[model samples]
Target: METVRAAERALMARLPEGTLMQRAAAGLAAACADFLGRVYGSRVVLLVGSGDNGGDALYAGARLRRRGAGVTAVLLSPDRAHEGGLAALRRAGGAVIGPERALGAIERADLVVDGVVGIGGKGGLRPDAARLASAAERARAAIVAVDLPSGVDADTGEVSGAAVRADLTVTFGAYKPGLLIDPGREYAGTVRLVGIGLELPPDPVLQALQHEDVARLLPRPGAESDKYRRGVLGVAAGSARYPGAAVLAVSGALRGGAGAVRYVGPAGDAVIARFPETLVSDQGPDHAGRVQAWVVGPGAGDDAATVAKVLGADVPVLLDADGLRLADRDLVRGRTAPTLMTPHAGEAAALLGVRREEVEAARLTSVRELAATYRATVLLKGSTTLVADPGGGPVRVNSTGTGWLATAGSGDVLSGLAGSLLASHLSALDAGSVAAYLHGLAGRLASRGAPIAALDITEHLPDAWRDVVRD
Candidate 1:
């Protein structure tokens, strides 16, 4: 929020008064017109508030009115409304109404512009505003939010109370973090950025990797690359209780661009049965042949010894599932080698000593806190997977996942995939982010709108990889 505010303030200083608002209003009007296929005879309702956001909507409503649409501005605070915007609406033949008549107008309109709150507004909407938001949600009209869906934290993506759920959010300047992360993301149906020429810093608070970004980070084996030269990932996972975990982990590692996967644990037989090519060893990770990186603790039921051994290996280690529980925080913090910790909201809550709901509610804060506490790159897996580096740079957010990924053994595959990337010499941050992108894409491809098993995701890894590096 502060970063956006600072940028807005800097931009507004050089621009003439009302110039920014007009630009934003123009973009909003254009988007609304595009959304309403035939705007000439459509009814548009503006849920105008007291902030500049309200001004943008009012001005947009005026533009719609001039285009032969019946526009009505329902002001929550008539006296506090944007003076210039209100005058423009009045001059353009747009009608004005108070909150008392907002419900009827919203129901009668073909589109509802939610400018009742903006990014600056915190917590939730006021009583009257909430009522209008509720009415807008119940109405048949398509809802459009200006800048951001009201009542969502633009910086954290947290929603405290009643918020506007828009069919489309026409945001100006830049994309807010809330637009990408969920509950807030769920509220913002589809986001459209309207560039108004505000200069932003190169390093943003959050980073979402697209195909080009992931392709650049993906490791490709060179002509001279041997198995060891390409990368070798070590897996110390599973137990007598859950041997499939080891097999799944190795499955993902094999497809994760690693030339070789070395397995060491009680599940060696199962690992070898599934993937005969894997170098299987009954000896612990300590005696396992040299490898570039290690993935520990997927269904590792009570294997604190193995987790500790992998931690001491002096190579990049991906800690997940049971590993996240058994690994020592002091040891994790003391390690000089890069460490990537993958934990779902439940596991993260255990690490942070908080409720799962709290961690889920504030995923950004929780991921950062976990990274700081463990002194490692932390990936908080959920609807929006986040990778936060211990040193506090921009956190990478991946939204490519489907709800079907909640199946068991999914984290195991992710751990192995990320560890393989680590072995390939990507930093913990890059490895985790790239692994998440690929994993999510694989999930989507494998599922294809249906339920899929964990192994299904591994099976589609090649397809996902090809899609990324493809032209």
Candidate 2:
């Protein structure tokens, strides 16, 4: 938010006063008009506060008033409201009501514009503002938030106390990190970005890779490439108790860019039965034939020795499930080769020695902290999977995952998919991000609204890949 504020300030200094505000108001009004379909005779209510956001709502209300809609501004702080905007609304024949009448106006409105708080305001809404937010929520009107949904942390997606649950969020200039991540993302129903032409920094704090971004990162083998030349992924997963984990992991690895998948575990027979293409070995990862990268810790039960051996390997490794629990912290941090740790909120909570609730509440902080502590790329898996590099540049946020993906053996598939990408020479960050993207898309494709198992996700990986690469 400091970066966005600084950029806003820099842009404001060059332009005339209120130029940015007008631009925002114009876009907001246009979006509202489009949403309403017929602007004439519609009842529009503005929940105006004391910030620039309030002015934006007021100006937009004035625009709607001119279009023959009955506009009403319910000012939370009447005296502190933007003077110019208030005057414009009055000139356009829009009614100005006190907070006392806010609820009734909101209920009667066809559209409710929430400008009670802006990006600058933090924590939660004040008591009076909170009541209005509640009224807007319960109202039969469509709620549209200005700039950002009030009470959501623009920098981190933490929602403390009362926040606006908007049907549509009209954000100006740029997309805030909160809008892209969870908690805040859930609050913001459908985001509509209105470009105000503010020059932002080259390196963003957060990034959400689209299909084109994933397509560019995906590795393609040449005509001359052999199986070994493409990349061989070593799978050190499963045990006598959970041989299915090995089969599922291999399912994902084969679909991933890896040329060959070498299986080294107690599940060798099971692996061979499911995937005859896999090079099965009864030996440990250390004894297993040379491979480009390794995926360890999915259903290995208590195999600490196998986890240690995979960590000692020179190539990149993806640690997940039981492996995340058994692997030594010192060994993981000391490893010279790239290491990617994929942990669900519960596993991450254990590693950080905090409550799982805390990790879920503050995912951004948890992921960054885990990455720094382990000196490895951390992919914190959840409703929104976040991939953060140890050094920290841009934390990639993945929102493509469905609730259907929260099934058994799903993490195993993710581990294998990510490990294969690492073997194909993608950096730890790229591997995690690309794997998450495809894995999420696969979940969506397989489920299609019904329930789906982990195998369904692996089965649809090719469709996800094709969806990304297709023109």
Candidate 3:
């Protein structure tokens, strides 16, 4: 779904006068009638605002009236309702009334349509409107929003104040950002888009990658593939303090279809102890001997020397955790091969010199900025993990991650899986997103109900792969 703000220019250029409004009203009426089973004899209350949004509600009410439904428009703004729509509603047997009259009628209705605000409006419900909507919330009928649940910012997806708690939100054209993000997302309920004759842009501002997309990107083993032919992933992770991180990373790499995983660091012995299959050596990235890709900084701490050695390598690198902290953007810019950065919100904020809240507010924009700034493919991890390539196109938000995947050391597993895929010769964006989807699916399988350890996530990779390949 693309943000509403991003489509304003195109909408203004193409939408004829009242054309989008009519399309919106028709879609809204259809959805409401479908939900009510039979709109004839059903009572619907329209909470009319002062803009085109109210116009949409009033127009929809006219349609319902023609079908023998009882419709009432509760005008929040006394003299500000859409004039043409208000007259049409009255001509079609719908009554316009004050809040007190509207409240009593709303209590007896089967459904309430909230037209309090629309895409252009910012902040939350006004005090009078908030109280009225709150009362409707306690009523017997379901609350359906006209454009979006009013009071949620269409641009940033943040709630300024109290928003109508809707059972369903019928949006026009593309989706607004507020419909997809956290606090605002909770109040939106199930969102349905109603196309209003707008052409979808070539590259959406934000996109959710589906299962088929991820399945197409998986590595297929060929007949000539050998251990080295498949690819070797060099891991420069772990220290005396956090040896388990290295173990988890190696575990993910081994299970991520990498032909071999070379572990290099002070915690090499610890890594080998957990997984004897991993080739452990104290040698850094340079001496790791012809690795296809390097996975750096999972648990290496703040050691400058080890981080420098890893960064200096000529191979494709997946930088995570401490590697992100130690990065010099200029050096990353000079890398000849592809580079990928995987960071959680906080780490991403630090790398981009912004607050964590800033990264969360405009996640799609922030991820793209991070990708462009570092000239690398950036994987911003969270509930909606986004992968943005530096050159720019649609940003992919992984909709597969489970909340159970929020546990510690889970990111290390992601980095290892992504690094392994990169080593297997996939493009940076494809490798990162594919690893995320598999890791997220594994997290769900590992933690059917209770909490799951990071190591448990490693064992489910094959299951995820099988499901994708089979489908």
The alpha-carbon RMSD values of the candidates against the true structure, listed in the order shown, are 1.2, 1.2, 3.6
Runs off by more than 4 Å, candidate 2: none
Q: What is the C-alpha local distance difference test score of each model?
A: 0.93, 0.93, 0.85
Q: Give residue 468's lDDT in candidate 1 (0 to 100).
A: 93
**TM-scores for all predictions:** 0.98, 0.98, 0.84
Which lDDT tens digits does candidate 1 get at residues 5-95?
A: 8888999999998898999999999999999999999999999999999999999999999999999999999899999999999999999
RMSD after Cα superposition, model 3 = 3.6
Steric clashes per prediction: 0, 1, 0
Summarize candidate 3's per-residue lDDT along 253-343 as a digit string, tens digits. Answer: 8887779999998888888888998888886766777789999888878866776676678778999998888877788877878999999
Q: How far in Å is the alpha carbon of 76 misplaced in model 2?
A: 1.2
Q: Give per-residue CA lDDT, model 2, range 324-378, as digits (tens).
A: 9999999999999999999999999999999998888788999999999999999
Write down the worst ten-residue block by lDDT for model 2.
180-189
